[model samples]
Target: MRILVTGCAGFIGYHLTLKLIENGHNVMGIDNLNDYYDVRLKLDRLKELGIDSDNALHQNKTVASDSFKGFKFVRMSIEDRENLPQLFDHNHFDVVCNLAAQAGVRYSLENPEAYVDSNIVGFLNILECCKNHNIEHLVYASSSSVYGMNKKIPFNTTDSVDHPISLYAASKKSNELMAHTYSHLYGIRTTGLRFFTVYGPWGRPDMAMFLFTEAILNHKPIKVFNHGKLERDFTYIDDIVQGITQIVENKHTAAYNSDNLYHLYNIGNSKSVKLLDFIEAIEDEIGLKASKEMMPMQPGDVEKTWADVSGLERDYNYRPNTPIKSGVKKFVAWYKTYYGNSNE
Candidate 1:
């Protein structure tokens, strides 16, 4: 299979690309490498796959490197329709794993336009390209945030997702709707994975895990929002990647009543963890007590999130095994090594 993985330099995308390449798939990866966080980390991930960090985006070129057999890196953005069509036509990709998006709930309030441009418009472009070409499967990253403010215990795929509290959540919900439209209208096979709070090594700096780790290491007071009374599924990166890999190859049939060649699943650890317990895990891992600063919950922040991944498990035999303690320990170890913090 030849796969087109957008946001290849990103946290999830980088891991997924490497997995696909390892599984003997021809993979073409693209990312603008925007400075959402540290570009150095993105470059370092690319280096692991043997991509040169020397201004490859400046030339708008695709480099065929031998670090991973049949892996090619292209510096491009999903918003660029002209180049995207050309790339699609040239490669005739068998599958597209769409992971590129402006992905922060709190940041979306400040920069709503970025979410609209990248999540909504850019996704439409992908739908158009997949429709034009004879692509086999299209897997996109949706979010558990889409179940905004719902008073549900475990968020399920069948729950009504019409009420979105944040712009980022709204954009993800819109992507799901748009993908369903593409599938219904053009017979395009699409699957949307609603990811829960994913955390592990090579995590995003904007996420809670990275922020808490950085603040703890820097001897700054870590803000404990909602009086340390929040819960998250906290799915590990490896588990999330495994769910994605299985779904990318498993195509859905167009059933009239229950299915339409379009499906959605919650990929997450079924159990939720409290904020205080999560922090304790980190504290235990780094062997440093964090100075706590109690604060009210920020806008677009949820009090708790639990995912119902029964659909994923039944369909794909998926089970997330990494407990919060083990996952946090792995992340803290990577953080210390990556930042050269001896204390951490």
Candidate 2:
């Protein structure tokens, strides 16, 4: 299979691209490599895949990996109307996994325009390219943030997602709607995955796992938002990659058919962990106590997120099973190694 993975420098995108390459699929990965968090982290991720990131943005570069024979990477944005379509015109892709979006819920409040460009306009370009290229399947990233302000216990895909609290969530919900429209009209097999709090090696710095770990390591006080009352369904990277790979492959007996082409599912670790308990896992793994400061819940934030992945498991026969402690341990180890201190 020839797979085109957008946002290849992103946390999930980086992992997914590697998995696809290992599965013997020819992969073409692309990203804008924006400085939303740290461009260094994004560049380092690309470096891990054997691509030089020097002057990447300046060149709008396309570099093929020498290490991975089947993987090539382009430095581009999904919203690049001319270039995105040109890329699609030149190469025939069997599937497209659209993970490119301006991420971070809090940041969306600060820069809503970025969300409109990357999440909305960028995704429209992806759908248009897919429609034009006759791509067989399109697997894209949605978010659990779409279940905003809902009091539901387990955030199910079937739950009403019209009331998104944040711009980021709104943009993601819009993507799902757009995908559904394209699928219905153009016969594209579009699947939207509502990812939970995904955290692990090469995770995003804006996410809780990285921030807490960084704060703890530096002996700075970690902010316990919502006064330690919040809860989350934190899914590990490996588990996420596994589930996404299955979805991209459409290998399950109950996978989407021509009649059921437009689909959405919650991909998450089913169990929800309290914020304090989750912090405790990090403390236990890093062998350090975090200096904590209780803080009010930020705006556009939900109290809890719990994913009912029953539908995904029923159809795909797989569920995220990484325990909190184990996942934290792996992340801590990766953090220590990625930075200077491997002894921790």
Candidate 3:
């Protein structure tokens, strides 16, 4: 299978791309490599994928991997109207895993346009390209944040996600809607996985796990948001990649309401770990106590997030099962090795 994985330089995308490559699929990956977080981390992820950082400088140019022959990467954005279509026409990918988006929920509040461009417009471009290219499957990254202010204990796909608290979440919900429209109209097989709090090796710096680890190591005060009352279903990277691979291979043909072959499911660790416990896990891993600054919940933040992945397990026979302690330990180890005690 020839797979097109957008946001290849991203945390999840990089892991997924490597898994696909190891499974003997030819993968072409693309990312704009924006500095939403540290671009160096993205580059390091690409380096792990066998792409030379020096060779990935120019935009719209394909960079072949030196280590993995089946893998190739490009520096591009999904919002590019001309180049995206051109890439589709040239490659004719069998499947597209759309993971590229403006990621952070709080960041969306400050830079809403970035969310609009990447999550909304960019996702539309992906749908258009997939539609025109006769793609067999389109697997995309959705978010648990779509459950918003709902009082539901374990967020399910069947739950109403009409009220999103953040623009980032709203944009993700919009992606699901857009994918459904395309699937219904064009008979495309689309699956949206509502990811819970994903964390692991090569994780994003903006995420809670990374921030807590960094601050703890450097003796900086870690801000305990929502006064440490929050809970999250922190799904591990390996489990996420496994779920994605399963969904990508298992093409959906069932008529979802007689419109198109479309499905959405929660991909997460079923267990919701409390924020304080999570911090303690990090503390245990790094052998450091965090200086805590308790803070009120910022705008557009949810009190808790828990995913009901029964639907995914029923359909795909897989669920995220990584324990928070183990996940945090792996992340802390990776952080220490990657940064080398540099507080920069």
Candidate 4:
């Protein structure tokens, strides 16, 4: 299988690309390498896959090798219309994993325009390319945030996701709706994975795990939002990669009432952990006490998130198995080694 993995430099993207490459698939990776956090971190992720600084971001940059058996990476944003079409024209990809997006919910409030460009326009461009090229399957990242403020304990795919609280969440929900439209109109098989609070090695700095770890190691006070009452279904990176790989291989072909192929499911750790407990796991892993700064819930933040992955499990036997203790231990170990500080 020849696959195009967008956001290849990102945390989830990095792991997913590696998994695909290891499975004997030729992967063409793409990322804008934007300074959402540190571009250096993103570069380091790519560097791990044998993509160096010199040839990373050049347009049509293709580094082919035996490093990961079969993998090539390009540094380009999906928002670039011309570049996207050109890349699609050059490579005949059977599947496209659209993991790229403007991700943070709080960040969305600060920069809504970025969401529009990356999550909305960029996603549309990917759909267009996939449609034009007649790609077999299109798997894209959606989010649990799309179920914003819903009183539902376990968010489901059939729930009404019409009231997203943040621009980021709204953009992701819009992606699902838009994907369905494209599938209906152009006969593209599209699947949307609503990821829960994903965290692990090479995780995003904007996410809770990274921030709490960084602050705890530095002896700074970690902010406990919503007065430490928030709960999240923190899905580990390995589990996420496995679930996504299964979904990509098992492309959904069920036709909707409109006679189009579309499917959406929650990919998450079924159990939700309170925010304070999650921090405690990190503290235990790093063998440190975190200074606490209890704070009010920020805007567009949900008090709790739980995923009903029953549908995913029933359909594809997808079950996330990494407990918070184990996941946190792995992340802390990776953080220590990667940053040269065992306690960090």
> How well does each candidate superpose onto the true structure, as a TM-score?
0.96, 0.97, 0.96, 0.96
Model 3 poorest ten-residue lDDT run = 251-260
Residues 24-142, candidate 1, lDDT per residue (tens digit)?
89999998888778889998888888898894555459887658878999898898889999999889799999999988999898889999989998999999999999888899999
Instruction: Rank all candidate structures by their lDDT, best first, as comma-separated numbers.
Output: 2, 3, 4, 1
Query: What lDDT does the true structure give each of the candidates?
Result: 0.89, 0.91, 0.90, 0.89
lDDT of 3 by residue, 1-344 (tens): 99999999999999999999999999999999999988988999999999999888688999899999999999999999999999998897999999999999999989999999999999999999998889988999999989999898888798999999999999999999999999889988899999999999999988999899889989999999999999998899999999999877765523333354888999999888899999998887777788999999989999988988898788788766678888887888788888897433
Which of candidates 1 and 2 is the stronger one according to TM-score?
2
Residue 137's lDDT in candidate 4: 87
Please, what are the lDDT tens digits per residue for candidate 4 over residues 40-80? 89988988898877788676677764367588888888999
TM-score of 2: 0.97
What lDDT score goes with residue 265 in model 4?
A: 89
Write the residue-wise lDDT of candidate 2 on 146-224 in tens digits. 9999998988888999999999999999999999999989999998999999999999998999999988887889999
Q: Which stretches of candidate 3 lie over 4 Å from their true place?
A: 251-260, 342-344
Top candidate by TM-score: 2
Error of 1 at 316 (Å): 0.7
Clashes of each: 0, 0, 0, 0
